[model samples]
Target chain A: MRTLAQVVSWLALAGTLAPSLFYLAGGTTLAAVKTWMLVCTVVWFVTVPFWMDRAEKD
Target chain B: MAEAPPSSAAEPVNEYEREPVPEKARLGFKSFIGQYAGEHTAGTELMIGPLFVASGVAAFDLLAGLLVGNLLAVLSWTLLTAPIATRARLTLYFQLEKICGRKLVTLYNLANGVMFCFLAGSMVTVSATAVGVWFHFPMPGLNDFFPNSIGWVIAVLAVGVMVAIVAAYGYNIVARIANYAAPWMTIVFIAFGLVGLREFLNATQTTLNSGADLWRLCETAIWKGGTPLPGQVKFTFWHVTFFAWFCNMAMHIGMSDLSVFRYARKSWYGVATASGMFLGHYVAWVAASILYALQLLRTPGNTDVLPGPLADGAAGVAGLICVIVAGWTTANPTIYRAGLAFQAVFPRSSRYKVTLVTGLIVAVFGMFPAVAMKLLDFVALYGLILMPMGAVIFVDFFLFPKLGLTSFYAERTGGSFNVAAAIAWFATLGIATWLVQAGYTQIYFVSLPGWFIAAGLYVIVSKLHQRLAP
Candidate 1:
């Protein structure tokens, strides 16, 4: 569970960073990044509490 | 009739005012990332982004300046604030009491609490703009200061009550809201940009055939570098960079985030701030700027900068929802912090009661539309007022022992108010205010110098005060 949450964290970071970098690099459209961001955001939200609970055990 | 009780009479929960955070309670890095992202990419972005366009910033300056300035902000968090927070694991007020003494820290808490209420009020105003859009209430203009309609007032009150209830529930609720809202807000902000971009391109008949064309459109239509809008300052690259960097100086360099980061398992968790800097300040800001630019394009004479109408015009009902949620997520935590500041002064008071009262005060302030209209200046002023104490903390924590001066001098001597800390805080503000008022330097530039001034004053005065002590 901890490992999975860590993976989700990285994926969440990537989801946020990619679109921002894409826009900065002059990508005018966000068609592709939107779907990617949505999935990552939902997954991150679900997994975070599990990780937080895991921290409790440690 | 029964006699009223004193303001400090109530009891508090989670008042961990005198101790370090327990090991089992520490949070992982990802928690900070979620909180920062949600807090920073908020309702203010809608207003602030538009103001940047109004200030006449060019694309290169806005973009490059934000990159550099935000990087500096992240470094300040990672290197300056997080280390001390993880070491001490105390709230900013407790830490201040140890260094500045209880009496002085109470005064600082008063100022901090009041400032936070006003800031949260501005967020309430942002949310109210969306409500105004839905009900077709008369909203304030860019230059308006007071609520123009009863509907606007009612809307603000409703939003304020909901935000207050959530805040009074405590940090877990606030964090949960942020985590849930952040991803959605990010997507909505991106959508706002896309819709605005398409609208602008269609309206102007500009084809995005090449990068050069997009750049040309950005320069001409979006952030046309020229004279600022009426009653605003012209913003250059340096202004954008410095403003972005110092806008949250209180939290980072001022060490207020000690409360937030103290829960972190590692100081390097401070890097989590990057999520907010990039996503909210960078992307959301640019998106909102695009929306405002489109507004200017459609109706050259209409200069109103209301976020609700701007966003609703861009993304309709979804945009309105974003404004409210963004405001709530941001203001919930903010009002919570304000309550903590006030509660620190009245340590026996219930945090929930204090938070409710703080939210009410914020709502009252929110009715005065000027707080939201002039948000850029207000945020800068907030940081300036709070930052000197941060400087004192920075120096006392890191530089004091190097100079053979004892740290936490107030605690060490059992003094109520450290004269050296008071002098540093007041003197720095006095000089910075004078510099701005006397036309020596602008507000954005004064803080950097004031930081150094405060640090130097603290070291010298602390040394003198220590030697002169009985």
Candidate 2:
């Protein structure tokens, strides 16, 4: 369960860095950044809620 | 019948005041995503980007440094702040209440609120410049820290009033404004980069345009890594990295954002900060630097920092609006947070009224030109001032038990003021000051090591204080 939590945290973290990464070489356009921001926003929005506890669940 | 009980009359109660932040307002994860992104991608980009150019950081450093530094900052929050916040679900105010006691917290709140006011005031001043461009009022120069004219005073008042009103209304209002302003502000920021490039090509009268040319343009026209501007220190990758990471040191690593992030559905919601880090810090800062670089190219003799004029040169009216609104969006949340800090100290006072009062204080300072004009120095100073408090909190959260002293010792001992917290706070300052006076490091360099020094000192002092006190 702790590992699962860590993995989810990592994925969410990936979501945050997505905007910056989009600025990297392969997709080096501002449009690419927006697309990645939107995509990551959607993915994280869906994935994060599942992990948020009603109280504290470790 | 009228007599009080003897036992009740004889005893005095003094446990650390623990105002566990009530989870009354349940905001979704999306709210936090927007809040962090919007807060981080603030209006200060107009100033910061240009400063980077002035600092003369190398291209490798400017680009790679921000990437690494920002990543380190995000990880610091997720790994350090979020876990503790979720576990305790307390505001820094509530947590500090236990450590600092009621009287000392009043002092801390004054310091915290005042620092925030100055910060918000600077943002207000930043946007006011854009308004000056629109109105054609006289603006401040690099050397002028004091308000130069009646025009400057009025412009800041007008801008401060509008921003404070919106913030005073509530958090939802601030969120809405950020939501609307962020996308548009980002568009204009990018346009700044594109339009400035066209002008650079026009002025130089060159034809070859490839990725190398683009990179070359950034190096020569934008960053132009060189000697420090007259009073400024040379910024390299290390400088830029640390600045980017610690710029909001109090908020994340210092755990000021506990109040903001407590509403998050999941602590992982911290991932949302990327939007601001990349969009505002990485992209927008570079774009504004390009604009500043273009300005330097045109008026090589001029050392003035007029974001309004620089933006005007690049994208005309849109740049002006972006600067003005950029300041407002950033300042709104800041003033709100400052007010909350003050309210925590006073407990009985209405937060709205105190924040409005705080807004007025910021506005009065906003009338001064120096704080905004000499931003780099003020930023460093502000970070240094707040860093000690952050260090004490970090230690109390993580290291107290390991030292064999009780965490929240003030609460346990019924001591209104923890002498140890007081020692750590001032000792760190004394050392940082001595270091500066001793000619060891620039003001900007003191914050990181200062944070650790504070945390360590607090542990040692708190242990000793507890042992020595009966």
Residue-wise lDDT of candidate 2 within B133-203, one digit each (tens)? 86787888777868878888899999888777777776555555455455456655766666566667656
Query: Residue B426: error of model 1 in Å?
Result: 0.7
On TM-score, the candidate that comes out on top is 1
- Model 1 stretches astray by more than 4 angstroms: A1-58, B1-16, B169-174
Interface RMSDs of the predictions, in order, are 5.6, 9.4
lDDT of each residue in A1-58, candidate 2, tens digit only: 6456546645654654444343433335545444444454344434443443322234
* lDDT tens digits by residue: candidate 1, A1-58: 6888877766774664465456444564444444555565566566766665465347
The two-chain DockQ for each candidate, comma-separated, is 0.12, 0.04
Runs of candidate 2 exceeding 4 Å displacement: A1-58, B1-29, B169-174, B207-209, B344-350
TM-score of chain B of 2: 0.90
Model 2's C-alpha root-mean-square deviation from the true structure amounts to 10.7
Question: What is the Cα-based lDDT of residue B277 in candidate 1?
Answer: 85
lDDT of 1 by residue, B71-110 (tens): 9888999999999999988888789999999999989989
User: Could you tell me the interface RMSD of model 2?
Assistant: 9.4
True contacts kept of each: 0.04, 0.00
Q: Which lDDT values do the candidates have, in the order given?
A: 0.80, 0.68
